[model samples]
Target: MQNLTPQTILKEKFGYDNFRTGQLDVIEKVLAHKHALAIMPTGGGKSITYQLPAMLFDGITLVISPLISLMKDQVDGLDAMGIDATFLNSTLSGQVQAQRMSDLRSGYYKMLYVSPERLEISSFFDFIQQLPIELVAIDEAHVMSQWGHDFRPSYLNILPLLAKIPGNPAVLGLTATATDRVRQNLQQLLGVADEDTILTGFARDNLALKIAHNVDKRQYVQEYLRENKDQSGIIYAATRKQVDELYEFLNKKGVKAGHYHAGLPERERQAMQEAFLFDEVQVMVATNAFGMGINKPNVRFVIHYSVPGNIEAYYQEIGRAGRDGLPAEAVLLYAPQDIHLQEFFVQKSEGTEEHKQNEYNKIREMNAFANTQSCLPRYLLGYFGEIVDHDCGHCSNCLDSREMVDVTTDSQRVLANVVRMNQSFGKAMVAKVLKGSQDATVKKYDYLMKLPTYGLMKDRTLKDLSSFIDYLTADGYLRIEGGEFPVLKVTEIGARVLKGQLVVEKRVNRRVIAQQKVTSAAKGLKLSESDNKLFAELKSKRLELAREAGIPPFLIFSDKTLMNMAILRPQTDEEFLAISGVGEKKFDIYHKEFADVIVKQH
Candidate 1:
């Protein structure tokens, strides 16, 4: 026990040979009784930092999780590794929770997972104080900051609860999607110094991000599902009604699908989630409610059926895919009207004026992500404060092979119109003024109709003009201000463009470019015919083992591991143990069964 280090624990327990990026650094800091905030990408092995330290420490490690399903998945995964961990949440019956608490008093578990809301209960708080708590790990730590996309009032109770704990346990905060603002707020609130922040960058290289602007979403989704029938994915819609409609549409097309949203009954939601997790359903059409606690590592894709309110939410949701370090796709189906729903949400939010305005800014940012023709991953990573100099050649934009045209003349027209209108009107009105529409609103303002910039782009349709305006705002040539009737203001860069000091270029409208067939094979491993057959057989066998063990198939073996096994064809215990995900426990339990299949195939 004294000689075991984090690396050995990682291999012995988690079955991985290396510490991914910042994992070891964070673990060393926590083990030294220091406070740290780790902002790694999703699937970047963040849990290993705290989970491994919890194994080394003599006392219990309390993990403050935000969702019940996440806790269940973590505890189950740990149990699969032959570790002692349990979760206490409202999902359990009163009698069961009481028994678990009684066991907790006896030091029966090494790690106890609970939501921050559980700490607010007087009795549970008193009970936990008596435990020998060594470290506190906060998952989804961004929710504590108002600047974060998902702010919860319940998270405010965490610091007070920790202050009352007897041992003054070291605190570790982990989040996959935190902007620089969110990170600063978290660091200040957690009393973690600037230098102690461990950010391994926010880039998922295996995800091929695509934005299909103005395409028939229903048609595109149907084609995508039909082509990738073997892969599992999640389709995120903005509303319960959309989820139901998309689910029904896919069902009508003979696709086995499930739908989940807050409107569904509790049991129905649970059943749907279980179906998706067990691989009985390959697709889950859900609203935002479905994914936070989801730990399904083999999810091959995550398609945004509609635009999200912010980049953080979008990034976090897309991060759900390709968690196993295998290639995945994140296709965002965006349309001009899709942004209206998000705008309505911002206007209807219960936050203060400042908060609401900030939300509006985020909506514009998300819109930019969808509208910009630049590298998709670079735009996403830039929003999170990591500046990657080169283009990610894998995104839709980089792969579009369309010719670039100078839009500097068109840009100056829009920027000049914003100034001509005194920058007091929204995008719709500005586009109307630029296109020289004879609408009553424009006709009523005689001065507007007589502006020098009016009818400057009369050759372009309103839709094209509107899209171009969005591109301008997204690329920082213009800014959207205020909440409800947000007006466009020209940026400093826009001024430069107007003064002929800068030139702008954009890809020709996608309608002019011939569309290529989007396929998952381009992003994932290209397997030979025999290897593909072997991989399918391995998956079937893994599913059988998972069902027998009452766990998800990924807990038995990830798709990536199975794919690697198919390619490597490990036929001996030593060879199987040399595989990437194979640990002693996994090798002891299922190595012989997997090796037998590989031997039989050869």
Candidate 2:
């Protein structure tokens, strides 16, 4: 036992040859009894950092997580690896909870998972008072910061819980999303030093981010579904109504789909989630309420049916795809009207004025992400404080072959009109005025109709002109102010463009093109057509195993591992153990079954 090392444990228990970019460093910090904050991208193997340490330490590791689904998935995964792990949450009955508590007192589990809300219970606190907890891992640590997008008041209980723990366990905070401000707040709260904070980066190389600016979302989704018929994906909408409508539309199209939202009954939601996870459903149409702790590794795409309220939420939502390290697509459908729903949410939210303003700023940034012509991943990375100079070369903006047209004159017309109208009107009125509408609202402001800026872009339709105004706002030439009753105002940069000091260029025919099929980077290791067939056979065997075990298929073995088996065709026990994601226990339990299939296939 004294000879055990993290590297040795990585290969023997987790069956990986090496650590990911940030895993080893974070593990080393926590092993040295320092509080470490790990900010790696989703699917960058975060759990291994703590899971490995739990195996080395003599005492139990207490994990504080916010999502019950996440805790369940992880506990199941660990149990499948022949590790002792259990979670106590609302899902269990009082008898079952008491039984688990008794086992925990007897040191039956090496890792214990619970929510911060559970820590507030006096009975749970009393049970923990005597346990020898050597390490405490806080998942979704960003929830502790007020500035984070998903701040929860219950998360404040974590600090007090840590203080009450007996052994002064080394703390490890894990989060995939955090800005500079949120990161600073986390460091202060967790007492992690600057040197111990590990940020591998927020960019996911396998995700191709794209935005469909002002398109028929239903038509686009229909066409996309037809193109990628066999793949699993998720579609996110801004509201429950949109989720139901989109689900109905897909169902009518003869799509195998399920819908989930907070409004649904608990059992129905769980059933829908299980259907998606068990591979009975190909698509899950849901709001942001879904996908937080879901560990489905084969989700090939994520489409935002409507824009999300902030970049953090948008980025985290897309991070759900490509968790298996496979290539995935993230498409956001941007309609100018979608901004209103987000704005309504912001105005009705309870917060300090500064927090509301920050949220408004985030909305503007999310809007910009949808409309900007720059590299999509670059824009997202920059928002999270990771600056990269190179364009990702695969995003929608980079691959666009359309001609560029100078829209400086059209932009000048719009910015000049905002100034001429005293900057008091919203986007619709400005577009109406520019298109020379003779409606009562336009007529009531008699001076607005008489201005030279009126009828300036009469050749374009009101919808086209309004979309162009949104483009101007997205590109930073114009700004929208006054939250609910937003008024268009010329920004400093817009002032320069209006003064003819700067020029604007836009793609002539702006549209969302269908994403071309991209081979997973893992597949670049090479799998022949026959290899694909064998991979399918192995996947069937995995599904059978998972069903027998009553767990999600990925927990049995990820798609990436199956692909490796197909390509490698491991023929012996040692060879099978050499496969990535094949730990000693997994090799013991299922190696011969997979090996028999490989032999029969050949």
TM-score of 2: 0.80
Model 2 regions more than 4 Å off: 422-425, 438-452, 510-602
lDDT of 2: 0.88
Question: Where does the lowest 10-residue lDDT sum fall in candidate 1?
Answer: 513-522
Q: Extract clashing residue pairs from model 2.
A: none
- lDDT string, candidate 2, 1-602, tens digits: 47899999999889999999989999999888789999988778888989999998888999988878668778988998888999999999999999998898898999999999998888888888888898999998998998898998888766977877887889999998999999999999999999999999998999998888778899999999999999999999999999999999899999999999999998898889999999999999999999886888899999999999999999988998999988999999988788888988999999888788888878877887788887899988998999999999999999988758788988999999999999999889999999999999999999999999999887678988877887898778888786556789999999999888998998863211101001222436677899999999999999999999999999989998888888877666655776668889998898889989999999
| RMSD, one per candidate, in order | 20.3, 21.2
The candidate scoring highest on lDDT is 1
TM-score of each: 0.84, 0.80
lDDT (10s digit) by residue, model 1, range 1-602: 68998879888988988889998889989998888999998888888889999999989999998877667777988999988899999889999998998898898899999999989999889999999999999999999999999999899767878878887788999999899999999999899998889999999999999898888899999999999998999999999889999999999899999999989998898899989999999999999988985788999999999999999999899999999889999999998788999989888879899999888888888998898888899988898989999999999999988678788988999999999999999999999999999999898888999999999887677998999999998899998888778999999999999999999998873323211101122235578999899999999999999999999999998887788788767645555666667789998999878887888888
- Candidate 1 displacement at residue 19 in angstroms: 0.8
Off by over 4 Å in 1: 509-602
